[model samples]
Target: MSSFRLITEYSLWFILPALCVAGAYSWLLYSKKGPWSPLLNKILFSVRFILIFLLCFLLIGPLLQYIKNEFEKPIFVFAIDDSESNTISTGVAKLSALKKEIEQAKKILQQEDYTVDIVTLSGKLSIDDITFKNPSTNLDYLLDKVESNYENRNLAGTILFSDGIYNQGLSPAYKELGFPLYTIGLGDTAAKKDIILKNILYNKLTYQGNSFPIVAEIQNQGFEGKDITVIIKNKGKLLDKKIITFSRNYDLKEVEFRLTSDEKGLQHYEIEVVPLEGEFTDKNNTGHAYIDVIEGKEEILLVASSPHPDIKAIKSVTDQKENYSLNIYIPGITEFKNEKYDLIIFHQIPDLQNTAAEILNKYGKDNSSIWYITGNKVNYASFNQINNALKISQRGQQLDQVTAVYNPDFNKFSLTTEEASVISKYPPVSVPFGEFKPMNNAEVILFQRLGNVQTVKPLLLFSNANDKKVAVFSGEGLWEWRLLEFKETGTTKVFDKLIGNLIQLLSSREEKRKFKVYPINSEFYSSDPVLFETEVYNDIYEKIYGQNINLTVTSEKNEKKHYSYVNTENSRFEIKGLSQGIYKYVASTILNGKKETSEGEFLIKELNIELINGTSDFDLLRTISDKNKGVFLPVTKLSSLPEILKNSSPQSIIHSNEELSEIINLKWVFFLLISLVTLEWFFRKFKGGY
Candidate 1:
């Protein structure tokens, strides 16, 4: 409803004078006797008098005020749980019928003058969104969202439809809500006979030739004194087996399997508790685990011309790792084997005699990576000739002491703040006094700090040439660094990390593929999209795009599915709607007239958690309604919700609004003034009163 009125700040007494002034002026003008009839004169006089009086009133600057009030009906929220668990106990046909009935109830509430909004866990407020296909449910999250979305609105209450089985978020029964709750519970509350593999525990990564443990938890219901065999297999090959007897109903047991990992890649294992008669579901009776096994320990060879403390320090750090075997050989004392190793460390080698010439020549051409640490006794000419990364020119056999300065621009590896800080303040090491120069391709990790100034000359650097990694250290006080760190912090962790990172970088092999595609993960759920990542590179190893790659996916039954990658994005390819199974895929692309292909396999496991334990918890729903000051009912009584909400006496809200404007600003007032002036002029001219 709205109303309008005119008001003025000036007093009403000011209007009386304006009225007298207008009447006197109009009577004087029209009282003249110039060629006019008396009747016409009186009529013209009244029009002029009224027009003049209205114009005089404009000086007061009156305002027009308007007030409006709006009434909004109370809103009722109907939230539904759209999860797969709802379809477990309630079949599809019944669920569909129930959904139609809920829609009818919405129409009834709207007819009764109450606003009804239908919402689901997906946040879409449409009846079609209740498909009962969402993988999980969270009742507490739904309640929180409704309260937040309609905080200050005229929300009378909420009507929720759920199965009381939430597996994603906190339980709704324990939460305190702001509005009254009416719950319509669905699903069966009685327990069913089922055998479920509750959980699996194992390491995702381990080394080959090492034994790892796999523990599986099993739960059984209504199967007392029943014997079952739990078997573990890999690619249909049985590795271990165990027998268990359920002592009572609802018995839970754990079976452990210790088996050696013999492969060097991702290994998929299947754990099954043999199904019995009359089971709720066979999907949860079997569990799967994928473990990636890395190749055995890496071999490292340390060669030196004489006994040095640096060799001992390097050996101590490497010895602590089970995946690394370190060997030290002093030229004249222990015989050095020329066998191939993952990494070779030359400590002040290529001395005055250049004794390591044979060893360097042998492994230099092989796949073994090399690291060089120079001391005072190292022959500068021999050192410069061995590695192309760094070159040094000694000045009359002199040695200089220098400290380390970290280079932040280095991208070959990373270091912690504490490690970089402690190493920068370390005691100076002895380096040959000379002109030091590194190649353009060398990546410097540490620069030399000369007394008070830091120089661009590299103290430690690495380079890759012909797919071989080479590192050079220009100083030789590594042992002192370890001791200083241990002295200050009672541990040499900082020192060890610095060395470990360098070794790991040089020892690891670089991938030589110019184009490849692989699965985003080793395992995926049946509901999840099977995604693969694709990468293409030029001859120089820079990223390239706009290439088409074809894929062929083969299932265990020899069924084939073919697809081609779309280059909308440079790195990701997605495939959806695949059932649970093990699949092998091959991706191939042609570049530079050569065919390159990548092959891999992935496992899609079952995620039908709703069928694992189809029992509902209606007691939780009752508790929620009781605590929130409402009533609970089975889904059969859903139509009676409208009557219950009416008893709560939901009232509509009235919102009032007011607006003010000057009367003179009204468009009709301006048009009226023009019309009165025009009429007066026409009548005066026709009657010859001008």
Candidate 2:
């Protein structure tokens, strides 16, 4: 187990000369008139020769090699699946038995001189404080933990116990753990009698006073000649209910119902299936959904100098949207008294005759966003005075037809690659001959193209400044662009989406609230973190921290929990490990001697992966065990793990390390050389021969 060697990279021919020099020095020092005995003289000459030999050998830079042995005990990783799936009645009763089996296995492995590490697998992997309350199961996450924690150690093998029903992530079978595995199968393999509410389909947004549809997928087994009632409710009030009749023992049904959205803001709804007489589990009989209802029909007003085909083209797009109402007017001839529209369109207005100067000046700085379209009739000096978005220096009154070139860097919103490609090839639009100069704050969505030449002119510009949002299109004849877009593509949906993005961007109002609280997700997969953000703005609309935001969560069981936290960066707060259920929360904070409160609801849905099929996949366990050169055992026979590992590969790893040492730098060598020279001197003086 241990050895030493002297080595050098030089040729062997130099060793003879080095020894001869050491012989000559020893004879000159000790062969002269010395009264010492022949044995003493031989000993002195030998020591002298050896010392001088080593001193000469230093020139060759000799190295000493030492080899040592290191003993490493075999490592065994034992992971327990501590997810909610194992908490069902079938697995719940076996908890004590599982613990006993694992304990016996651990004791036997330790007796075999193996290092054991136990871990728990769930939504997240942790130490072996096994709690079967994790709402989700991620088997690969546990394997990743084993790989990270046991790397660079004497890892011999791994043993796992689970039902083999993984949800929320990839299966652990595919992960290359690079070690043999021994799997113990858990959970029942026979199908259980259960009725499950599989999934729901509905829209998240709808108009108030209108009915929306909700659809549910229902799956049932072993429940023939039975009726299951599906009910929908809101705020503890029943909205709709229906009974489903099964035609066969195993049935799949789709049920649809309509409910009126009569309230604004976020509305919470619950959907449930009445539990059958002999169902396996009832925790999955209910689910939650939400909808947001808003006011109907955004009002859009279009003002122009006279009736043109462009007015009809713009109206065609807005008219198709059930949520938009379009009204038209000829600026000087029409009576435009109402200012309640969400957005105003100014086309060739504010001419030398001052057609819409008053309306344009009033809305240029206010909150109502405006869109401008320029043409030959738009008076340059008067238009600049009315809308401060863009300036134009006209060389003549002539109108030039130019095609559109889309800007890839425009950030107002996104346009699909196909739409951007199609719009770039559209027919030319009419623009007054001039140099179009947009302000610094403006973002150009499109630039002007003269034939094949693209120019740095604002064909379409958007700006938000002075608390106002404005969009200007320095051209007309968009009716031509619409026609060309339809010609290129079979449908106008692409063009419609382009126009819709513009309208949606312009119609959106900024949030000016001083106090706000929002959740990252209103619905979470059980075991997911429940997070909320809180913001308190001063009178100047800047966020300030150091205030306690008290949050209260009320469960459906009428249980209330209180929590208080102070806001940090970006006014954020998060809580984790919430179970599956519907709950309402209220956030309250004191601001400027006044208390403000906001309320909302969130739902944590259960990870129904285990419920998807109660039957365990023993074949999956067999495949994994066999693939890793391991064996599979039932939950009842896990006690033989230690004997199996004793006969496994790599019983005990004996590690070896090689270390190098310099002969010249060895302390013992230096001390021995000095002692030898001192001994010879003392002996010669004692004999009166020096």
Top-TM-score candidate index:
2
Predicted candidate 1 versus true structure: per-residue lDDT over 1-690, tens digit per residue:
999887887986878988998999998897776577788888888889989988988888788899999998999999898888888767689899988988998998899899998878866678966688877787888998889988988888898898888887888988888888989988788888878888889987779899999999998888878888899998788988998888888888989999898777777799998999998767678888777788877888898888999988998789766668887878788888766688999888778877767886777556579999988778888788768778988899777889998888888777767678988889999888879888748899999999999988889999887777889999989899999888888998877887888888988887789877888887898878888998877798887788889999987566899998754454588889887667889999887889988898887877656655677788989999999997999988887888889989999999889999887888998999898898889998997767
Question: How far out, in Å, is residue 62 in model 1?
Answer: 4.3
Residue 536 accuracy (lDDT) in model 1: 77
TM-score of every model?
0.71, 0.73
In model 2, residue pairs whose N, Cα or C atoms come closer than 3 Å (at least 3 residues apart or on different chains), thus clashing, are: none
Please report how far candidate 1 places residue 298 from its true position, in Å: 6.9
CA lDDT, every model vs. true structure:
0.85, 0.79
The parts of candidate 1 lying over 4 Å away from their true place are 5-69, 122-125, 297-512, 520-523, 538-544, 556-558, 569-571, 656-690
lDDT (Cα, tens digit) per residue for candidate 2, span 559-626: 88889998777645877767756778999999998998877887776656555556577777888888
lDDT, model 2, position 232:
93
